[model samples]
Target chain A: MSTAKDTAGEDMPWDEVTPEAARKLLVAAVEAFAEQGYHATTTRDIAGRAGMSPAALYIHYKTKEELLHRISRIGHEKALEVLSGAAGIEGTPSERLAEAVSSFVRWHAGRHNTARVVQYELDALSDEHRTEIVELRRRSDAVVREILREGVESGEFDVPDVPGTTLAVLSLCIDVARWFNTQGRRTPDEVGALYADLVLRMVTAQK
Target chain B: MSTAKDTAGEDMPWDEVTPEAARKLLVAAVEAFAEQGYHATTTRDIAGRAGMSPAALYIHYKTKEELLHRISRIGHEKALEVLSGAAGIEGTPSERLAEAVSSFVRWHAGRHNTARVVQYELDALSDEHRTEIVELRRRSDAVVREILREGVESGEFDVPDVPGTTLAVLSLCIDVARWFNTQGRRTPDEVGALYADLVLRMVTAQK
Candidate 1:
């Protein structure tokens, strides 16, 4: 679940995306969309990035929106997988929440280019696709909320509002993708550690 | 400093911008940029929205990029003013920090359409324009950092990483523009209050 190493290696986080050409198209589309945004990036530009012809792009995906939908779906699935992995880890709620936040932050920082497009370009997706993506986001919300709820029930966390705090926590972690820079002082691991510590501080029992 | 009422009435946050036609163009640009993104919004579209001819747009602003630069500059100034106002309030570090986050969050949520364009369309700015906006952003950061630094010095807050926490706090407030909806369950004031509480919890001294 650690995406830290993927930032510097050929072992990309998109390994699960099958059919090499389709994955290539998807990867190219992510770059195009990130750089030029969805409305300005043409299908031709995505095809050119993939070293394929526009005809070839059509062979795989019908429209640019489809490429974005695929990226959004796949990205959300990976995000959910990472959160669920940490949530199920054997530990106290504090430990679990820390793990959840650190791993989640790691993904957002390390894969920021792709994460930016996945998280920000939702308005460009077709309504049907967006509905599906929204459901996945709700699941992500549920995962974090459950952790806070468990901590509160166990008297380990002093959250006044579980749902509201959950949104704040998730929003804090998610915004990392918007500002994370490779040339910045902190590495992904450092940010993940700092954020996890801060998040734990947010929920720790006040005493 | 309270922007909570701006979401519902005629008193707009963009009143600082002038003349009436230029202000109309800026307002139109914000709407167009928010709905279709920076790269996709045409000069003609902006002029049309302002009920002006495309040639009239060129008369007021040399190019579309210039229009964006003006919006960004104004928006950043407003954000800095909001942060500075909260920072100067006579209170403890905790009170100042809470006010800063709550007011900052309110602006993002209340004036979200402009905030959305201001915060998200940054990459589309010319390098010089972006640099100017980035400098304004640094000032905003300094205000938050000073609050946290004072809190640490006063032993009222237990922040180990002032800069990192400042980034998280600002990022959390700024992202309200990304997801804030008028039709949503929580009003701008409610979100601002909730975020302020959560942020205080993040920095409050641990037992």
Candidate 2:
């Protein structure tokens, strides 16, 4: 970790990576994995995309799985930040939940190329890495579940099942990565807005 | 189609593949594709799994892509049947919508391996085949959207965005294939019931 700072500024701590070159390689890996699934993509392909020799890829990522780990870790962190940011905002539960869904969905749609690789390729991770990533996902789920619990408690929402709805909401947002296309009629913002209103209807008390 | 019945008694169209040998190859392909992915799973591996020679495999399916197409086609046809059946049921729009989600989610959870390969591996299909599957998917979406429209007209629901909610609802159910595991705490029935209620909440006037 110190070596990274000794050579380059300490912007982040991944698998002890975040250098500009490492970051470029990681982005290339994400594109390769997204375009042609994790198992199908080769290290040679990733290195080739980044315009780096195959040997240079190993200087940063020990293996292709490591590259996937870094991408998934970063993606989950962004997802958590988006959800928790909305959940922590100063607003009613309905407002906050809408904010959470809209922003989270927006990220999934806008960064769908990376999100697709991160969200869909969990099975490709090593057992230990997958466990760690699952922990991150569990926490992400908790963020939304807590919002639903509060909504139910405040009598602001009529949710019959908090955990169930939480799963549905997260599933709903994650799926935008699977289907959203840049050329499609709905832009990320439109989808985000549409989901926010639909989610509000899912929870808010009837007038 | 008649060839199927001439050789083997036609009990069912898709879920029931004709002859024992053909069924084994399809099941083997589903497992291989799910485990290693469509792009990585070789025809030899699929044939090996089915305990057949590679030459024998071609008699039933022309290529690995054809196997994927068959699995995807049958899976989607079944999905359409479930949604259309639920929509055609005698009930309120809310009841029908709930039934549709419940059954769809149940299939995704119970047959998660096949569902995972089918729903997630669309990009691997040939363009002509994918277009056909997309048509099936479009019809499936229309089933749900039609129900939502009926709910709005009947004043049974208060959705501000019918088309948007339809997309969210399908996305919510399809994602069950991604996260659900039979060995996990929840059973297919449990998930189906939970989604049914949550979906009702999404559409119906909040009570």
Candidate 3:
């Protein structure tokens, strides 16, 4: 539920970096950040989880903030790519939008620990880093907005406020990280499929 | 936008805490908890925000956890009351559900800083306290579930899974706290109205 799962059935196209030690540190950092939150997590905790001395963390990442920046940048970049990938696939607007939501929701629910840290810990980033991340976030929004626009234009969906509905869809997906429990009855795929169907209902209003 | 204001257009039924000092401390705590999160925020920091000594905080509700408990309890209790109030009203199922979503979303948007802490920072509480708080949360879910069940039973709504739709509806409303910004375009009332319409579409599937 937390780390290192195959992207089968889900559309998580994240990469594992080279230099096994650094990847270990990054993975450890994600767990720490998810469990204790960004502000409360310490460099020592990350280092200890990675089986290294405190000073060892500085060799790869200068500060705890840098670790967060790296994780966020990569996470958001991959998330944007996932959205765009689904959006660009050959299909009707509804099909593409459903694909996007299914995969996007799956990523958030399946890899929710990393997603939780990525989504909620933006404030801990310095301004420069945050601006970069926010730009990625905006692009992610544009992907969804463009799909909604296409749906409306094609008469497949009847969204009155495309931008507002875009935000609502993304909000609904992002919140899976906050509330999705592995112990719960539904699997990530089940939740993702349900959300995809529900989102289509949101746009088309099928009774 | 973050603090006190008239609930004229917005249907926020929350009452401001009585006793000026307690209110001040609660407001300060909400700001601190919202900014730094519960684990990173200390009692001293919360007291300082209220312009009180560290010891002065003890005169008001004991430890930092107590402050969070008080805030969370009151907020959830009010939220439950809001939902049940709207549900208990004499109206069609759609009307009552819309009223519930509108007022509940309004409360979350208008008082989002407090809501952000109450919704997102639950893991910071002690085990005993969290158990108590979780019961309130279940009650909140029950209110919405009951309404959805009524809607489904009446053949007014087309939801296949009442429990799943209930979770989605609540998730949509709860996450307004995470994303709603005062500097953004819509007011709380507007957002509430929009969400009410959307929730109606979600249930009724009316274009």
Models 1 onward score TM values of 0.94, 0.90, 0.91
lDDT of 2 by residue, B1-207 (tens): 323321112112344676778887987888888887888788899999989999989999998899999999999998899889878899999888888998998878867777888888898899999999999999999999999999999999888888888888998889998888655778888999988877787788745
DockQ each: 0.79, 0.64, 0.57
What does candidate 2's lDDT look like per residue over A9-58, in tens digits?
21223343468789778877877887778998899999999899999999
| Candidates sorted by DockQ, best first | 1, 2, 3
lDDT string for model 1 (A1-207, tens) is 224233223124576776888888887888888777888899999999989999999999999999999999999999899999999999999999999999999988878877888988999998999999999999999999999999999999999889888988888888888888888999889999999998898889977
Can you rank all candidates by lDDT, best first?
Answer: 1, 2, 3
- Please write out the lDDT profile of model 3 over residues A1-207, one tens digit for every residue: 224453222223334554677777887888888877888788999999989998888888899999999889988987788789988999999999999998888878877877888988898899999999999999999999999999888888899998889998999889988888877888888988899988888888343
What's the lDDT for residue A160 in model 2? 80
Q: lDDT of each model, Cα atoms only?
A: 0.87, 0.83, 0.83
Looking at model 1, residue B21 earns an lDDT score of 86
Better of 2 and 3 by TM-score: 3
lDDT, candidate 1, B1-207, per-residue tens: 223233223125466766778878887888888777889889999999989999988888999999999989998998899999988999999999999999999989878877877888888899999999999999999999999999999999988899999999999999888887788889888999999988998898866
Ranking by TM-score: 1, 3, 2
Candidate 2 or 1, higher lDDT: 1
Q: Which residues of candidate 1, in runs, are more than 4 Å off? A: A1-11, B1-11
Q: Candidate 1 chain A: minimum summed lDDT over ten consecutive residues — where?
A: A1-10
Q: Counting only residues 3 or more apart in sequence or on different chains, how many pairs clash (N, Cα, C under 3 Å) in candidate 3?
A: 0
Flag regions of model 3 displaced more than 4 Å: A1-15, A205-207, B1-19, B205-207
